[model samples]
Target: MSPPETDIAVRLSGVHLQFGKTRLRFDCAIGKGQIVAITGASGSGKSTLLNVIAGFETPDAGKVEILGDDVGGRDPAERPVSVIFQEHNLFAHLDVATNIGLGIDPALKLGVKEKAKIASALLRVGLDGFGKRLPPTLSGGERQRVALARALVRRKPILLLDEPFAALDPGLRAGMANLLLDLHRQEGHTILIVTHHPDDVRLLADSVLFLDGGHTLLHEPTAQFLDHSDISAVARFLGR
Candidate 1:
C-alpha cells in the first residue's frame, strides 16, 4: 500500500538519467523520518541516485518530491536538503565555527543566535571546545564530525550522505553511525545514505534500496534485505 503523501518524506517517480550507453531509473518513496541506505556495486549508480535527489544531477525525466512538495527544476540550495560527503568538504582556511556558520549563512554574517546554534551543533557532534581549530589540524574522524555539525546547523528536513563515513576506520565508522542514529532520534530528519558497506546498512538504515545497472532492484525492510530475501543478485552481493 502506498503511504499517504504527508507520511512520505521523499518520492522519486519515473526518474531517468543517461550517460553514454548507460541508462538509469529510480522510483521509490521514503517514509517520514526513515533512514534508508542505497547500496550497490561500483558503477551501479548508488551515488548518482543521491545526486539526483540532492539536485546535483538532473534527471532526464522524473519528479522529485520532498516532504510532499514537487522540487523538480529546483536548484540545489533552494531545496530543503543538506548533503555531507566523504571528504567532509571543509574549507582549509576556515575555522570550525566559521565553517559551520557557513551552513546558516554563506556570507558569514552570524548574529548571536546563529553563533549559539553553531555552538550547539558543535556540542551535539562532540566538539564543543574545538570550534576554533582549523580543518587541517583535526583528525579525519573529527573533521567528519565537523561536517555533520555543519549539516545539523543547516536545519534541513532531509539529509543526504554520499559515503560520508567511508574514509573512517572501522571503529570510527561505527562510532559515527551511532552518533548519526542518535542525531536522527533527536532531529527526525529523513536520511538517505549511499554506502558501499554492509555494516553501515546493518547499523543505520531502517530500510534498504538496492540498485543494479542503474535501476532500483529492491526497496525493502532492512531485516528482509539482510536475512530473508530471495533475490539472487542480493545473495551474490552479500556472499550468502
Candidate 2:
C-alpha cells in the first residue's frame, strides 16, 4: 500500500529571520518519507534554513511544526530531529565506539543492548572493525561515515544535513552518497539536506527547494524543478 497522503513531516509558515542586511521569510510544507533538497547560492540562507527546522535558530515571526506537532521555540535536543554538519562534528579524543555511543547515551556509558546497537550501526555504515579508532585516525570519508552512524543511531524521524559531504572529493563523495541512499532506504526517515551536489539532488531528492535573500524562491518536484524552461535564478546559479 502507498503511504498516507496527509502525512506532513515538516511545516513552516510565515517564518521570519534577519541578520542585519540579510532577511529571510518562508512558508513551505514537506511530505513524509521524502528526500528534499534545499539549494541556493552561498549567502542564500540554505544552512540557516536547516538550522531553523533543527531548532538551532528561532524564527522571528512564525511557527515550526514537525511530525504534526508545533515545535516553535523548542530546543534542538528537545525536538525530534538530528543534524549533521559538513565539518563531521566528531570529537578527536573519542573512539569511534564512544562517539557513536554518544548518540544513545551522552555520557558514553554503554550496556549490552546499547553495545549491540552501536556495533550494528557501525557495520551498517561499512565500518565493521574500525570502532576502536579515534576520529583523527580515520580518513575524511570514514569520518563522515562515522558521523552518519551516529545520526542513524539517534532514531529520530527527521534528519537535517547541512552539506555533509561538501568537503569530500568527487569519487569519495559519490560513494558516500550511495551509502546515504542505502541508509535512507533502510530507515525510511524524512530527510532534508542542504547541498550543492547536483548528483545528490538527482539521485535522492523527491523535491527541490530554492532559496535566496532569506526567502523561498521555489519549491517543486525534482523533475519539474529541473525541466522548467525559465529558472533564470537557478540557471544563473549553474552558469548556464
Candidate 3:
C-alpha cells in the first residue's frame, strides 16, 4: 500500500553549501512518493546535496524540510531519511543479517519483530536466505542489494542513493535499477538518487534534475527533459 499523497516530501528553500570557492544552492520541492534522478559532472555537488539532506552537512543558509517539517538542524540519525552510498557501506566484521539489523538498532538488539522486518527486507531485495554471508563473501551486486535492504528496513520517509550500482557490470547494474523500480512501487517512499547511468534515469526516474556548476539548470519530467532539446544541459549531458 502506498502512502497517501500529501505535501512535498523534500523541500530546499534557498539552501546553500559553501566550500572554499564553490557554493551549491537549491530552491525546489520534490513531491511525496516521487523518484527524482540527479545527474551531473563529478564535483557538481550532486552527492553534497544528498549529504545536506541526509544531515551529514548543514547548509550555510536557508531551510531544509522533509515531510513538511523543517529538518535543517536534525542529526543524520534523527532525520526522516535513509541513504545508500556508492560504497555498499557494509561492515566486514558483520554478517548480512547483522549489518541489516543495524537499521533496526545500531546496537544489534533484535527482537522477533525486528528480525522479521530484516527477513522481509532481505526478501524484498531478492536476497532471501542469504543472511549469514559476510560482505567479502558477497558479489558486488549482492552487496548493493544488502544496502538496499538496509535502507528499506529503516522505513524512513525519504531515501537517497549515491551511485548505487556503479561497481556492477552493465547487466547487473540494470538489474539493480529494475529492482529499485519494483521496490519503489511496493514501498512508495520518496527517493532521490545520484547516478551517471543514463539507462537508470531513463528507465526509472519520474523526474530529471540536471545540475551544473553549482546550480540546477532544469528539473522536469523525465520524458519532457529527454524529448525536448531546448535544455542545453540535457543535450550536453547526452552528448547530443
Best by TM-score: 1
The TM-score ranking, best first, is: 1, 2, 3
Q: Could you give the C-alpha RMSD of every candidate to the true structure, in order shown?
A: 1.1, 2.2, 2.8
lDDT of 2 at 215: 88
- Count the clashes in each prediction: 0, 1, 0
* lDDT of candidate 1 over 75-115, digit per residue (tens): 99999999999988999999999999999999999999999
Q: Please name the candidate that would achieve the greatest lDDT relative to the true structure.
A: 1
Candidate 1: deviation at residue 215, Å? 0.5
User: Ten-residue segment with the worst summed lDDT in candidate 1?
Assistant: 228-237
Please give the range of 10 consecutive residues that has the lowest summed lDDT in model 2: 1-10
TM-score of candidate 1 against the unseen true structure = 0.97
Q: How do all the candidates rank in terms of lDDT, highest first? A: 1, 2, 3
- Tens-place lDDT digits, model 3, residues 38-135: 98778888998899899998898999988878887789999989999999799998899999999989998899999999999999889999899999
Error of 3 at 214 (Å): 0.2
Stretches of candidate 2 off by over 4 Å are 1-5
How well does candidate 1 score on lDDT at residue 117? 97
Pairs in clash, predicted candidate 2 = 24-214
Please give the lDDT score at residue 176 for candidate 1: 95
lDDT of 2 by residue, 1-240 (tens): 223537889988899998998778988888898899999788888998899998888888989889879998789999998888999899999999999999998987799999999899999999999989999999899999999999988899999999998889989988998998899899998999898866788887899988976789889898887776577878765556
Show where candidate 1 strays beyond 4 Å.
Answer: none
